[model samples]
Each structure stands twice: as structure tokens, then as C-alpha cells.
Target: MSYLSRSRSVYGPTTSTTCLNKDDEDDDDGGGKTDNNNNNNADDHPGASMKQRTRIGTWNVLTLAQQGKLIQLANEARRMKLEILGLSEVRWLNFGEHRIPSGQILQYSGLRGENAPRHRGVGFLLSAQAHSALMKTRVRNLTIIQTYAPKFSLSYDAADLQDKENFYSQLNATVDRIPKGDIMICMGDFNAKIGSDNSNYERFMGRHDLGEMSENGELFAEFCGNNDMVIGGSLFPHRRVYKVTWVSRNSFTEYKIDHICISRKWKRCLLDVRNKRSADIASDHHLIIGEIRLRVARIPRQEERVGRQFNTRRLDDTTVKRSFTVELQTCAADIPEGGSVEDQWTAIKNAFNVTSENNLEERRGAKGAIQRSKTRGAIYSARQRYSALEKKVKRSCRRDKRAWADSLADEGEKVAATGDIRLLYHISRRLSGAKINATMPVKDAIGQLLTDPTDQLKRWFEHFEQFFQVPARPPSPRYDPPRVSEPIRVVAGVRQGCILSPLLFLIVIVEILVGAIDREPNRGLL
Candidate 1:
């Protein structure tokens, strides 16, 4: 089937992969390739022929909770041959990994409470190919966080300042947790405008960035600098349309807020980063894609069955909470007190598990059906009205079109506020397309690329073996010091969150460094 026909069939009449009108085409910067072959070529460099190429993309899907949206996204990824897709505002509840019927694995993180609105969620959808190479996933509070920073006209408030500080703190903690040797790609809707100025920030930024820098942009740039990450979008040459991820409802303004960044050490792995304006999803945001060549090993299978997650949401009910407490007490009482520490621990664990099974709810199926139905119906109605307005704008005169567009924009906000998640998502998507991609290839000790998954794994093993290899110890000193008669006691390590922990750590590190320096044989030469 033709691409257009397939898109129409899957997405319905309102959405099309092609531009709405000839004028829309004119706005396009021609940075994106429409043909599949062109895309494949664009993703692979001539020198990277022997390397395995993986396409990673990021898009603000508005909300994954929308009916059929998750499946639609998976299909789109398949069509585009994207190996990994990072999604923002997924709106999925809780934190977990799920395998879709298509064999794709989706790892999502969202708010914890059952009563919490499905908002500001983030997730990664990995194709079978990418899923096989997955090593680990770390979810942090602010890693996929979103907040409304003060705009140019708005003065900064205490709440806004606190929010920004909290975001930065969480972001730093997340970055610190990443293994330095592993390739890191950090991308999202930063909501910061990093202009074309490469001044002082030349190490982490490029001249290709669009618009002038904002206050948030400074924070973004500083974060990249500290983490040694390079902005992917700023390094590539693309048209204005391809560079800009957002457009105003009036169509008179555009901004490049969505960005993808990678560790500067793995910058060469990124082949390209550009906006795919032709993708026809309900969301207004264009998809941002990045190409990289990397080798990855499949995870070994295990025979262990995963445990069922306890629905902690049930604890909100007073009756359920009371029942759970009574059941837990009863179960614990049955465990005998006369046992070894290990046996007692195991018995206590079993008691909790049994109580949970009996008292806690099981989260095995779709949740919030009533709310979902209401939201879905509202979104559908809003979409129909928006479609009508779009058609009218297309056929109307310039002045009338502007008025209609403004009305359409206002209507979108109203639907969003009404908890029509899909409509709200499309509005956010149209205004800010946030996406990110990063990848790194595996190589052997001799710098030879390892294409096979098994070879990649073996190469990593060999590389680490050599890296951690300790040299032979020198012969023991002829004169050994006499052992002390007094008993030596070692203090326990400092608690992580203690006020003096950082200071103590710093002091210990300094002492170690000083001792090492004092003992250095080459100290006299210095």
C-alpha cells in the first residue's frame, strides 16, 4: 500500500503524512527525507557501513492514555524503523515495564498516587531490536519532569523558583547516577530557547541553534557543560522548519524548544537530528528523530517469574487499609519467634506477601475506565470541531483564516482544561515537540568494532577485565613493622543524607590524596 493510503487508513481522514496545502510545503525546510531509502541513507554514514545503525526518536505524544494511541505510536515507529522512541507526557499511571502485543517493550514512569491525574509522565518504547540490547533503566523524579517556567512577560515567583531548583536538583542526581562509561542521551522538552549564539558555551552548544537564549536556556547550557553533553539539534544543519519544533496558533511565530542531546564523548555516534514534519499524528508537534550507529548485546533470559505489583492505591480506602493491617497482623502472628535471623526474616517476608495477596488489589488490567471514557468522548468531539475549523481556515480568506485559527487555538486550550487528554496533548505537541536520541557502538580492546551481539558482550567482558587488571605487587619490605597490641576499631560509614556526610567524604578523599602524594617516589622530581 502507498504510504499516504496506509496513513489515512490507520489515522483516519483528519490526519495525513503530507502537508495540508502547498503553502505548508513552502514552510518546510526540506531537511527531512520523505523516502524510506533516503532516511536509511541519512542515518548511516559512508564510514559507518560496518556498524549497526539504530534510529532513536523522541516525541511528545501528548498522552499515551488516549485510545489506540500507544498502538498507533508503535506502528509509526515500525514504519519509520525507529529502534528506540522516548515519549514525553505519556500520562501512564505508576512505574513499570510492559510488553505490547507487537513485541515492543514500553518502560514508563509517572506519578505514584491512584488519585493523581495522569500528567507529566515520561517513557521509552523500545522495538524488539532495541529491547534486546537494553541493559538497565533508571527512573528519577525529574528525569521526565515538566513544569511551567516564567515566560518573558511574567515575573519569577517563589513557587516557580522552587520548581526550577527542584528540577535542577533531580536532574543532577539523575545524571550523577549514569555510569560514566555508558553512552548517555538526555533529551526532552526543556522549554528553553537556546539561541544561535555559541559564545562562551561553545563546548556544549553549536551555532545552528535557533532563536535567542532565555534564562532557562542558560541553566540548560550549564547542565550540558557540567555533564559533558552536546546539543544534537544545534550541531546539525537543517531548514528553519526542520529546526523549529513549535509554531504559534496564529502561524506567525515559531520556536525551537524541543531538543535532543548526547554526551560529548559520543557525539560522533549521532548521524543526524531533525524534525519530521510530514508525520501525521493527532499531536501538533512534529517528530524529532536521531540516527546513531551502535552495537548492543541481548539480555540473557531467566527462568524466574516476575512478582505481581501490589496495588498500593487500595490503601487510600479506610476499610481496605484496616483490613490490610488486621490481615498482616494475623499472618505475622503465625510465624514462630524462635528462629535464626535469616529464617525469621524469610518468615516475616512470607507473612507480608500473604497478607498483600489477600488484602491488596491486583493491577492486572486497564484502570480508570470511567474517567477514560469521559475523556475520550470529550477529546473526540473536540477533534471533530477542530477539524472543521482547520477545513474552514484552509478555504477562507487570510483575515478570516487568522480569526478561525485563533478560535481553534482557544478551543484547544478549553478542551485540554476539560481533561480531554488527547486534545491537550495535541495542543502541547503543536506548540512544543520535545524529543531526544543517543547511542554508542561497542568496540574491542584493539578498537575493532563488534557487530555481533555475542561479540559485543565478549568484547565488553575483555575490555573490563583488562581495565580492572591489577599489576603484580612488589616484594614485601624486608623489615616488617611490629603489629600493635591495642585493638583497632573502624567506624561505620556516614549516612548518605547526613549534614556532615559530604564534608566527611571530602576530608577522607583529601587525606587519601595527600597520603598518596607523600608516598610518591617521583615527589623529589616535582
Candidate 2:
């Protein structure tokens, strides 16, 4: 099977569904490489090759009219075997109604608030397979939105300063919401350049610095620099194709306006950026596709820690003196009969072992440095684990409240029917701070509690949700009589007995009559 088909089969739609034609399927099963299959084998089977690399890409599909071209791009990306694809300038109507031409499943978001596209909206499309791989480690909190404020004012006057501030504020807010360590690709026609050649980008933008730094593009560049972000397809060092996204909607002026930026944490993962000539003409904006190798450094659990002795002593003069004495004997072996004064000095220097003593001290310093690094790593790891556990615990507590509430309701119905509503009410009041007793119906109280979960319970539930990673919604309590209590009354003159007990009584009577007969054997009329 071809690599693509194999990947699709292993992680794609079910094998039962055949989107490909019969001929296509034949070609797929025949030509599809087994590399992906081998990857699966490594996971499920033994002695399999490990996945050491992953490739990611990004693209801006021009317009909805070029849907066919978009699909072709997606196919090309798939052909390139991209695990993650970050797409920009994808317009989606209200309530997410647009369909991607590429069959590749997409996780997208609609434009923020109305004012969609703002002129042009930006969206992201990640390969379903890539998402799955990421989900294994951490869930992706991808944010896709469009931001555009006409930078080029009709008048020669510069754009409003507030506009730039507002843009940065919105951008920062959006970025803040994204979970840390998540692979995020923020890309679009930012309508700005990050760096410049002739004029220092920073100097050109005057001292009207607000939340951000630049006037045209330098502000964005500074913001990215401070945030430790990398500009993908940077035309620095050597300019390949510099182009602008907007040019009178008809006039063509090549400018590298549209771009993609990634976090510096993913620096190693960024593999290559291919600015295809075909892609540039495909859209008004040049298509800058980036290929990133998604790699996870498999940290081998520390070798079952061997207990090592910690020594505080440094290489001292005593050790150096001892080494010098040992070298003195060796120096004699090097000397011949009647050597020059220079030769004698060299022999004395060799006997002193000065270089070896210095080398020993440096080695000790290096060891100390290594120890400190390991200690810091351990501390950091511990802190992260603690934070994760704390979050989990909080979530668990929240879930427990609902569970505890349900239990109380079940037990409450029984007590309520037995005129024990007060007892259940006290329990609810104690646990969830909701009172349900003779004065209040259980259903009404439960509704109120769910509607307004107290801070304590809310916190508990949040933690509960975090840990269990499940919705913790309790069912509304209903007064079911069967689950409660009922009065009981016995009917009069009704003998309820089995034959064994009744027969035993009769046997006792016969035995008594026989005993009486024994006392008077001839008494036939008893």
C-alpha cells in the first residue's frame, strides 16, 4: 500500500468506507509504502523502528473561488507527508459552515464576533492524524481568527496609534488564552514587516511606543522577539521573493507581507520553508509553506538511581605534592648524564606536575557545574508535576460533589418518605449548602443548587472536571415513591405459615396425647 493510503487506513476513516474509486483503491493497496504501517507496528508490535521525525506545513488558500486549487494544495501537503498543517486566510461563514476542499479533516474556528475576515479572516487546518498524535501528549488549543485594520490611511497621515495598540492588545489576549507548550501557528497578512535593510525597523517607528513597539512592522517584530517567536519564511540573509498581499486589488507589487510565525520553543522542530513559485501566482498572496519536523525527545527515565557518595573536598595541595613526588622518580628516567641547565629546568617542571594539578581542579569545577544543572532540572520537573497534580485534585473534588449529591438524593427520597426529609435536607445543606426538607421539595432545591453552585462546590467541580476530564452534571432529584418508604398494615385472622411448622405443631399434639395415653393407656376418648 502507498504511504498515504496506509496512513489514512491506520489513522484515517474506517476501512469499511471507501472514498477512493476501485482503481484508486487497487493502486493504494499496491503502491502505498509501509512506512506508516511500520510505525503502527512499532507501537503495537515488537522490534519495530521508532518514529524519530515528523513534518509540518502551513499555507494560505487564496479565495473560496479557488476551492479546487485549495484541494490541490492539501493533496500536495499530504503528498509531502505533513503531520501538521497550519492554514491562514480561510473564511468560514456563521456557525462554521464552510467546507474544506481537501478531504483532510480540519479543526477550525469562525471569525471572532461578527466583522468576519475584518476584510479577510484567518483559519487553521491541522491534519487529523497530527492532532491525534498531539492529543496523546497534550490537547491542542488552536486559535484561528482574522485581524485587519487599514494601516494605509487614505490621507498621507499615519494610521491611528490606538489602532496599533488595540491590535496588540487583542493579539496578546488571544495568545494568552492558548495553553502553553501547545504547537500554535499564528499566521496571516499581518500588514507589517518584521525586519528591514536600509532603515533600522526599530528607528523608523518613532517613540510613540504603546503596548507594542513598531509603527508599521517593527512593533510586530519586537513583540514577537520579546515573546520568543520565530518568523517563518524570513527573507533575511538572502531575499528570494518579497511581495505585498494587497495592491489596489489589481496592481501587482511583490512584497513579503503575508507570513507565518511560530514560538521559539519549537525552534528545533522547524525543518524548512518552501516558497513555491507556483504557489505565489496561485493566490494574491505568496504561499509560504513551512515544513517542521515534529520531534519528541524521549527522556529515558533516570537509570535506577545508583546511590553515590557526595564529596566536598577539592583537589588540594597535599594531593598535588604527592603527584609531584611520584613524577620526580619518572623525571630521573628522562634525564641523561651531563644535561644543559634548560634541560635541568624542564626536568624540574615535569617533576612538579603543575599542569596535572591544574587539570584536576578544572575537572572538579566541571563536575560541580554538572551537578548544579541536574539539580535544577529535578526541581523544575518536581514543580511541574506538583502543579499538574494540584489541578487534577481540584477537578476531582468538583466531580465528587455531584456524586455526593446524587447519593444524598437517593438516600434522601427514602428518608423523606419516612418523614425524614429533615435529615436529607441537613445532609444537602452540609455538603452542597442546599437545604431540601419538609418546607422545600427535593427537586426544587436540587435545581437551585445546580443553577448556582457555590464557589466551594464550583471549585471542587472544576477540579473534578480537570482530573476526570468528564462532564460532572448530576441528574435532578425526583420524588420516586418506590425508592422511598411506605406504610405497612397486616390483615386480621390471616395465618401465614408453611406446612413444616404447622405439621410440627400437629406432631407435638399427637405426642402429647400419646404421653397422656401412656399415663392412662386405655383412655380412648381424649
Candidate 3:
């Protein structure tokens, strides 16, 4: 009846909502009437309260060449209390009305392609009971691509690395299509590994190309990192004994080939990874399972339970297995110390809720770095091409000069006429800066003509003739262009032209110092 009692009643019955720890406490109001009233309110609002843990599992069912094993696998999944199940390596016959005995309904779909006949695919199995509990929704932020890369066999020696690159590119584009703030789960078997290992039960840390130390594995690491996904369930406590999927009926060597990866935003949502490894099963590969916490609305119908409320998408069977395994490793690593299963789920909820601008900026920076590296590489290539072209041009110029001098002898008659002689001598001088003198004014005049138009050339020629009282010969012993590698120095006893102004001298000195420092560390030492 009093304010304190009313306030106490409003905040009553605390439930654990913090990370990794759950503790329950009941506080009574000062007035017994407040407690009675609050209890009455709680009774009427059953939908307003209730807590449930949602379990999700992922597996790569190397499609039992037999229908019976497939059904058994589905039933086992149900028996395991898996509310949501993702399966890879599902043949078409294993889908579309095939009965899963757990009485659970798998709302399934597959990728569109010409290989449909092979029926190799990925899908989701919703416990029919679980499906009946929640509301249904869909999100298509990323494109789920299922591909079986070429194995390094004698028949296919050429590497499928390029194909893998293109596939990842497409996958990233699909992930980008999803708008920010929307829940997007891009999961499946990416035939790549974080790294090679003999362990199926132990934690296998993924590596990146950054260094020899493993972060994630090669292209797989790059793909998952670029999309911000975690490789769940791979970091468990057991070494893989039978790791390979898709085994030939007679082959004995088993390889750990499948993997699962998820966005970093959903890191906390991951719970546990279960891998079934008994060799007695008809399927060659072990069944992988991923457990996830579902935050369900308390008041939903059976179909509206957490099942329908959580966003779901279908993946290829092969991809599902791969991603499941990857996620298994990642989830194991994500488990914080001293947290309940509930706490782990809560962490995932908080982690995957929404991507912040900080995340986008980080991705942008990474992409920008890649783009810049590519741009720099292209610039270097262009410079190399230009340098090659410059050398070729120099060689051709030298050859042309030799040919022109040889031709001068054939035009001997032109040397006898003034205008013809001037033209012939000009051409020769232009071809090679090897001759000149006042007596041979034609040669000197030709060299002057190179720097000026005909009018200025004529004036220079006239001035030369009048000053020396003879024909204006080209300056004997023509000037040769300096070689790039040669040190520029005025010869002893040779006239050095007028020097530049003091300001120009200062600028030149500063430029020289900067250039010297940039090109030669020894100069700085000096």
C-alpha cells in the first residue's frame, strides 16, 4: 500500500541476466499486501516470463549411400534434443518429403544449379515440436555457396585455387548484400581448413597469411576474416581420427577436410560442438553438431517458439559440415571462464546483435590496404615498361644516326650548291653532332637551326658570317648530349658559363641536400 512497498514489488524476483553467472533472489515488500498483489500479477502474465535454452546443431552427413542411415541420423539428432539442425552432404533423395523419424520437421532447401541431379546439398531441420513454438522470419544477407573443390588427384593435377578464390569473392559479395542491423548467418562447409591436424577432439587454432603462426588457415582464414565470422567447434579437446568426408567405398586413408565458420558478431551465441566418430556408422565422416542459445519470446505458440522466431537459412550438406566443424573449434575457444551455458548464449546475443561503425571502418581499412598494395604494384609495373621503352628508343636513335651519315655520300652533288649544301649539312648535323667551323658555316648554321625557327636561324647565321667575315659554319666539334650516368664537370681551361642568382643557388643547394639524403644514406653520414 505504501510507496516503498510498491517500488519493492515492481523490482521483485530478480533473475540472472549478467554474463556467466545466474543467481536467484526473492525480496518481500514491507507490506504483505504488495507481495500478494505482485504474485497475482505474475500469475496473469505467464507470457511475460519464462526462460529457455535453444540448442542448434550442424553436421556433414556424407549422405548415407543408404536411406536408412540418413533417417537414423535425423532421429539421433532429435534424440540429442537438437532444436535446430544444419546438415551438409545431403543427396536430393534425402530431401523433399523424406521422413526424419524424430517427429521433427526439417524446413529444407538447396542451391540452384545444373548439378541438381547429384542432389548433393545442405539444409536445416527444425524439430517439428520446436517449429510449432515460435514465429517464423527470414533473412538473406549473405549468399550461401556450396562447392566441392577439385581434389589433388592424378586426373586433376591443376590446382583449383583460382576457382576457390572466385567462390570466396562471390560469398563475400553475398554477405555484403545483407544490410547492417539484420541478423545474417552465413554458415556451411568451406572445404578449406584453419590448418592441418590429426586431432578431431582437440582445439585446432586457425591461422592467417600474416605469418607462420596459425591464426586461421590460408584462404579459409581470409574468407572468414573478411566476413567477420568465427570458425566454431573446431577447437575441441580431441585429435581428429577420421577427418575426411566423401570417402570412396574402398579407400582407407581418412583426412580432416570439412570446416564451419561464422561471423564474429555471433561469437557468444555458440555453445558446444559435438562430433560423432564411431567408424561403425555406414557414413565415412563423423556427424558434427553445433549448439546455440536461442533467446525466445515467452508468450509464443508451439510453432512460434524460438524455432520460428530465430532467422534461418539453408546450406549445402558439404558446406554445413565444413562450417559446423570450423565453428566447433571457434566456439570452444570463445567459451569464457566460469560461465553457464546460459551465459555463453547471452554472450552470443550481445556479440551478434549488430555490427558497429567501428567494425565497418576496420573492414574498410583492411580493404583499403589491399587496394593500395595493388595500386603500388601496378605503378611499379608501368615504370618498368617505360624504362624498357626508353632503352629501345635510345638504341634506335643511335642506329638512325649511323645510317644518315652513310647516306650523305650519295648526295654529293648537293654539296656544290649553296641552298642544297646548307640543307644537306643541316640534316647531317641533326643526325650526328660530330662536326662544325666558320669555313664550314653550313654545318654550324644547321646546329643553330635546331634551337630556333628559320627566321632566328637566318639571323644567327648572318651574325656569325658578319662577325667572323666568313660563311657562318656550325660551331666545329658539335656538342653531344650528356650521358645520364656521367658526372657533369667543366673541363679544365674551359669557359664555364654565367652562374645563377643567389636565391636560385640556395634552392639548388637545398634540393641537392634533400635528394642526397633520400638517395644515399652515406651522404648524411658525411
Q: What is the C-alpha lDDT of each candidate?
A: 0.60, 0.43, 0.42
How big is the positional error of residue 519 in model 3, measured in Å on the Cα after superposition?
Answer: 99
On lDDT, the candidate that comes out on top is: 1
Model 1: residue 331 alpha-carbon error in angstroms: 75
lDDT of 3: 0.42
How far residue 249's Cα lies from its native spot in candidate 3, in Å, is: 6.9
Q: Which portions of model 3 show Cα errors greater than 4 Å?
A: 1-53, 93-102, 110-116, 134-159, 182-186, 196-217, 234-254, 278-281, 297-526
User: What's model 2's TM-score?
Assistant: 0.39
lDDT (10s digit) by residue, model 3, range 1-526: 0000000000001000000111111111111112122223335533212122345545666564442455556656655555455565555332232334445644333334435454445555655544333322111111122233223322422245555556566556545644564333444454444443423312223321111212214566566556666666454444443233333433334444455454566555455454544322234455555544333222223332232121112123465446545655565566586779899887665443322222322222332232233455654554445445445444645665567666765564456454676667666664454323111112134442121135546766787778889665777896899999986775434344435444566887899888878898765837
Q: Write the per-residue lDDT of candidate 1 for residues 1-526, one digit (tens) a residue.
A: 0000001010001110100000111112223332233324324433212144456677877778744577668877776766567776777666555677787867666666679777776767766644553322221111211222223325667776666666766677656754555556777666778999989988988999788998778878888898998999999988786897765533346788778888787788687899876453456566788876442333344434445457576688899899999988888889898989999999998988888867663211111121133455654554455555445333433455466567768988799779898877766654442221222345566764344558778887887899999999999879955579854443548554668866886898999888888899586435
Per-residue lDDT of candidate 2, residues 1-526 (tens digit): 0011101101001101001100111111123223343334335423223223444444555443232344555655555555445444445432221234443544333345555442234333444333222212211222222333235333435346666666676677656755574555555556564434423433212221112223456656765666667665452233333223332222223445555566766544454454543332134454455543322222123334332222213334587556545666666666665779998877666544543444343333332332234465654554445445435434645665678778878887788788876686776675664322211111122332121124336755666677888676899898755533654433333454544656666887999988887888777645
Q: Can you give the TM-score per candidate against the true fold?
A: 0.47, 0.39, 0.38
Best by TM-score: 1
Off by over 4 Å in 1: 1-50, 133-153, 296-386, 389-526
Provide backbone clash counts, one per model.
4, 20, 81
